[model samples]
Target: IIQGYGLTESSGSVASTVGPEESKAYGSVGKLASHLQAKIVDPSTGEALGPGQRGELWVRGPLVMKGYVGDDKATAETVDSEGWLKTGDLCYFNEDGFLYIVDRLKELIKYKGYQVPPAELEHILQSHPEIADAAVIGYPDEDAGQLPMAFIVRQPGSNLTRQQVIDYVAKHVAPYKKVRRVAFVNAIPKSPAGKILRRELVQQALSMGASKL
Candidate 1:
């Protein structure tokens, strides 16, 4: 895929991934272009994280934007004095050095101090035998802070049921990563570019919280 990088103050996505082969690397956003410099930083302390470690993605270089149009505080929070843009994205680099997007920094769920990634559950759901598509979102919880919930679209004419989907993911993933709730819909709502609309799915999960199936 052709790749691009950008900053919040300058603009979104300064560099973009292009070409057929580059776009197929679903694990990562893509390689950096000549004009950009990207770094993965430790979210906990703002330290630069090494390859293969989960952290926030940061960028600088030519493709970087100028600065805030009006809001200095907002600009300051995102861009440091040295001009490095603090991207709120959560991701890691593969062994081959391609970037792998995991989740947003704020969307990461803390389950009793253990971080639970919603995207991982979605991947597991998509792998299920009867699921055509799936979306997982974090829901507020009294104790865990946030819990993993799933929404799925079954394969056409497939006989799988809600409990079956839940059991399937539960059996394969760690308990903390298991789908606590499941909802089967006619289709998985998505953006025009094909990203799952997590906000809507989270609302649907809340509405179906009391239902067994």
Candidate 2:
């Protein structure tokens, strides 16, 4: 499948599948264009990571946006002094240099100081025949710092139970990654581009006094 990575801020795609030979690689956004430079860096330390090491993706190229209009603070936060735009996306490159997007760095769930990627749980939840869609967020917990919580949309006529949801994830992931809280909803809020509106769900969970699963 043809795939590319781009954002409105970048004007358009800076990387895409080049040809039939490159299109054979699965789960990649293809190689970067000649004029563009990209790197995967440790989000906390800014240290560059090697291929196959997942980290925050950064890009610097003519295609990158100059700055946000009339928003110096936002611009400063996004574009570093070296002109590299912090994409906020977690990704890694394969040995063949194909880029693979993971999940958003900001959306990672922290449980007992361990970082848990919400997308990993969401993916597993969606794989269940009884679940149509899912979104995962970290809810504040005094002890664990944050607890992984899931907002699920069940398949039509499916009678999935909360225990089943917890058990399913528990069996698939490490003990720390199991979803501890769950809320079933009619639908998951998403953007026009189909991106999960995680912030909205986080707020909704808080307003509903989100509790244990």
Candidate 3:
């Protein structure tokens, strides 16, 4: 219900969507808390953005970890020049204080020059009538450097093919956003925190290559 974003070092409690009736907005994560302060910084300029805008999410609070115990380089890279905690999540807060997760800052693929967000593609794939669940990831390609590939789980007793999935994405997303490859899977791998293990899928798409249904 109440979804908030934070890093593992922060104890993963900086943001959470919690409340009995909060489940209505299934995709919108909830806002910050008494001890938490969040701001959006433009990845390129490091300028802060207002509500309803998207950017890299930053957090500052006592709950945030100073850095890794021994990984000073990793800690320095993540904490940045300021004391803010880099959450590495692309998201926005609505005017009413609801947070909406867009995608991961690191997972975005570059096509020619455009940023292709895998989470956006995955959301579209999951919306298909026949799809039970879906995961989208970027794979290396010579032309564009990287492209999205969707792995889907279909509804019980339903039949869907690679081409059908491809056509479905084509119908819904922009040409650049359309998934270049698709693989039907028994289920989409997820973590205990409900996060998809996209890195694994990216590896699979590389070996499996893009194929039409």
The prediction achieving the highest TM-score against the true structure is: 2
lDDT of 3 at 24: 67
Across 45-78, the per-residue lDDT of candidate 2 in tens digits comes to 9999999999998999987999999999999999
- Candidate 2's C-alpha lDDT? 0.90
**114-208 per-residue lDDT for model 1 (tens digits):** 78887788888889778898887777788887777777888998988777887888888888887776777898889997987888877777777
Residue 139, model 2: lDDT of: 87
Which stretches of candidate 2 lie above 4 Å from their native place? 210-213
- Candidate 3 on 159-195: residue-level lDDT in tens? 8888898998899877888877777889888999798
**Candidate 2 vs candidate 3: which has greater lDDT?**
2
Candidate 3 lowest-lDDT run of ten: 204-213
- Candidate 2: clashing pairs of residues: none
Give candidate 3's error at residue 84 in angstroms: 0.7
TM-score of each: 0.82, 0.92, 0.84
Instruction: State the TM-score for model 3.
Output: 0.84
Better of 1 and 3 by lDDT: 3
Deviation in Å, model 1, residue 126 alpha carbon: 1.3
- What's model 3's lDDT at 143? 89
